[model samples]
Target chain A: MNLIEKYAAEVGKYLPSRNRADIEAEIRSTLEDMLEERAQAPNADREALTLQLLKEYGAPRKVAESYGAVQYLIGPRLYPIFEMVLKIVAAVLLGVGLLGFGVNAVRMDMAGPALVHALGKLFVDSFGGVMMAFGNIVLVFAVLERVLPLSDQKDLTDEWEPADLAKEQDPDRVKTSDLIAEIVFTVIFLALFNLYSQYVGIVIFNDNQWTFIPVLTEAFFRYMPWINLLWTLQIGLHVWLLRKGMWDVPTRLINLAFKLGSIGLAYAMLIGPAIIKVNTESLAGTSLAEVARELSPLSQFILVPFLIAMIIAPVVEIVQTVIYLVRRRSSVPFPVK
Target chain B: MENDELIQNMVFELRRGIISIAVLSLLGKEEYGYSLLKALSDQGLEVDQSTLYPLLRRLESQGLLQSDWRIVDEARPRRYYVISPQGREVLAQLKKEWASMTESMQKLLS
Candidate 1:
């Protein structure tokens, strides 16, 4: 390629893919035109003039950047939620790390340098695990940044109204944070249930290493397709709510429909085969062996309440939605200010 | 700041704010990037290629200008830009604002 061709290509590398060719062509044409003007002067050398033209045009990267392409991994519109998620994830990781450390420390019967060394090693290992978790979170957010539609990622071009804020009181307003949290959690559950279901069980430190016990049963896997369908629709709903920025009648009805689906799933899970299983046999010779033996049969007793609550909470929400669909209260729970 | 630096900075600020208005006004006729640059320079409104091209794209994206690439009196293909109907309306308003601003400044300075 010629010097101008090379220069344009370098600039094209930095432009967004959507408009890269057009921009590159424009830059090249402009440079050639400039060079043409300079060449009209007496004794002008074409190559020398081309070099001077490119120099005046500034560096290729700088020229490309002047177009103001979207530069964020997680842009300003999603930044607050990203920050909130990072904080929540960091705290949860720290709590789990400390809990793990305590369990390992309790398992240790040493009282001197051995205990310190083991504790030191455990701390280092936990720190590494936490760092890995943070990296995974960043990866997820980066993917989310690209995966979200341009309409959602970039600030909306629509005319905004201060009156809209006044109308969106506490109950009616869509909290971006709440929708984002819902999306994040639903995505996590989907990933966990589908990709990392084997690691869903209780992990016990045994025989000088960590042993992962798969807690979910085959019955749960049978229901996987249904669960995936519901969760996918649920994520779609959340994205719609995020873009709409408030709940109206139709969205509430849609949400009510999803909640009813949830009730169906919960009812089926309650009546059907077990979803979670604790194999005390797998926990033998570990720190949780005795506890597992005691609690394995009582796992249903622990799980039944949550399933019942899941059914009950959605029922109540459904009732409320029907009531609101009948008549929405005008009273705000508190002052707007 | 040095006097030269102060002058350059102040001139840059003045130029940056009005470049949009000037470009909008000048693009009443369809012109490609280089022709547009020369047109502006001929009228003594100095602007960088970096500034002008991006501004053109931005204004187009904002629905104020329309552009398309076609060969126009040149062997090379060039992206020609013209003021849109929306741009004409905006430019009229901007022109009024500019006139009022300059008039007020003239009064204050006098």
Candidate 2:
């Protein structure tokens, strides 16, 4: 009915139902006491005094918040990591979406309505991607906050030792950028191999029309299961390395195993039938027999050499990893400070 | 401005730490919220009503204080708080700690 009562009611609106009545009664009593003390002055207007006392108490919502226990969808412990992940995901989505739009726009007639249409599509697509990424990330963090155990949560704030500082600053520390790049590439590779295998081809522009000629044959699909497993493993490894913030012996050994597995798969593919379709019918202005002859040498010059390089690259990595492990063993470990 | 803010923050933290002890000491005698607040202010330890009221409820919930409503002559009932046995024990411990902390600080400052 009066200013104090109205203020208490407003504060009670923000408070939980269980304690609202009791808290409101307490606030009203305190307000009355303040009013009584203030009213002892000469010519004290009761209404004016009530308003002044309420103002000093703070906003109704703030008063309620002070009384309530602190609640967070994502608490301070996870906030920095959540923010970092959100930034990376949003940036990647926006970057890739816009890049795709840009390429398509450039291929269109620049002076026509098509370019404007493409620009509009670009805005809408990029906005949708960013929103989806943000929502998914927030949902994940909220779930993590609820399900993460108290002990595991200590990883966010546990004190670091001098040895940790040494490990972080070590010259051989795994580069975050390199690991991130590997993650991105592995994801793209997996998506293309599994989801868009049919679209893996060479685009030839002829007579103002673009034709996508299928380069990879059914033989490529045969290797899909193995390739998918390797790519998924690589992604998991990169994510672990990122969380660890440094690579140790076990990580290097896992990296070595991945390289060895990749080489073995590449070798298997090379020894098998040609993986490229080589559809002679798809060759424009050429007879089937002539096209077939042309494909035989092209496969040798292209596919064979490509497979050999894949094997050689992994062999080189294995040697380097071995050398790194040997060098690490001889070096003195970081002394405790 | 920064120095003033730093001092303000430090003073606030210092006051916050001792406010519970001050409240418990005053509530040794059963008093309603307004009277308890007035009693503290009269002793030169001014506290905001919003802070004091919530703190009283929290202490009560924690079993450090007990409260009951009393009605007088058909007027608005008042909720009165008093320090519990547990509160008295805690207050004694706090006083001992405060005395030792002040002694150590005095020596360090000197």
Candidate 3:
């Protein structure tokens, strides 16, 4: 149509479909009113003035944005399941990558720099594969986003209370040994941290004698009461889980609490201060000197960040705990007399 | 420049809060979009076209304003907006609120 009509149509492109036609007509009407008023002024050229009026009004996209048309591709209703599926896909990709890497390494019969070169190349080649996998997932979710109607939100949403996970025959039964093992482990860990924290440091046999460097900061000790409370409650939770012989709501909740506490404590230690110390000078003339330089002082007194793998263990454990908590509740049936 | 921007934003917010009341008060007499803009401007309440049209549509959607597309004086069709019964009741309450608010504000400012 005309220039003003074209501008209105352009603005209509970004408006929500329900309001698009009505808004476009209103915009065209307003623009004509503006043009008529401006063109009546002295030295007014209708074509030049219409162009300036549209320019002053702003770009089509921006004018449309001012109306606040928010459309989420994958809304909150599907986001949780999307995240779980994404995590599963990532883990599968990592597993496949490792398998391929192992097979390639075995077949090549390469060593030293050649193996390192192959490993580096493997990572570089992985970028394309990861992008493709990620793209496919997003496409699937985008389709699902539009296909799922608003009426089905209640049926699909996680508003319902989490159900009890146990089967009728043995739903409430706790694997007794798991709790016992955890209790023993936590107790020994508490003893090591609380009773003998000073011995928990880097000891080097230098000058034909052992020298221990104390490295736990004040921040680390300040966290001790909270840490002690968490571990003690952890032991108590295990004991209660055993005595009860099943996970009740309260038991699971307490476990989640202590689990959160441990997470908070670990996160604080990770970000706050060096909870453990190592002396590079002490490790001089030793192979560990380079490693000591690589390792940041861990804030975990009990976690014993000797291996980085152990630090990650707590995170993996908490994730599984959350899944377990979401899946199961105490659903024991009363017996008939 | 920054202070000017800040004051402009604050003024915008102030107008946004009260523009509804002003529109409802004036819409006792039916006015189309351009004519309503003119009426508001004539009363020294210069509202943006973008802001006013959307507001008219929204207020209509909310059942506070009634509108219909009609041509007058053999001219082009325009959506004429008038206050709904609900809008009159809301405006009556809002006038009392505005009076009370201005009284307190005057006391604070003085």
Error of 3 at A57 (Å): 1.2
Clashing pairs in 2: none
Q: Over 4 Å off in model 1, which ranges? A: A39-52, A110-170, A243-246, A267-274, A282-305, A329-337, B1-6, B28-30, B61-74, B82-94
Please, what are the lDDT tens digits per residue for candidate 1 over residues A216-325? 88898999999999999999998788766678777887898899999999999999999998877765886778856754676688689999998999999899778865
Q: Give the residue spans of candidate 2 off by over 4 A.
A: A16-18, A36-44, A68-71, A102-106, A109-117, A139-337, B2-12, B101-110
Q: Model 2: DockQ against the native?
A: 0.53
Residue lDDT tens for model 2, B30-90:
9988888778889988787767877888899899999999886665789978999999999
Q: Which of the numbered candidates is closest to the native, going by highest TM-score?
A: 1
Residue A256, candidate 2: Cα error in Å is 23
Per-residue CA lDDT of model 2 for A1-337, tens digit only, reads: 8778899999988888888888888788777766777899999898877777778889998999889745678887667767677677667666755654564445443546756655665565346535644665576567657654444332356464556745646755656545554565466556556766655544332233334456777787899889989888998887677566667788888889999999999999899977875566657564333535454466567788999999999999899889877876877586211
What TM-score do all the candidates reach, one by one?
A: 0.80, 0.54, 0.56
- Better model by TM-score: candidate 1 vs candidate 3: 1
Please give the lDDT score at residue A162 for candidate 2: 50
Chain A fold similarity by TM-score, each prediction:
0.77, 0.50, 0.42
RMSD, each candidate, Å?
A: 5.0, 9.2, 18.3
Off by over 4 Å in 3: A75-88, A112-129, A147-337
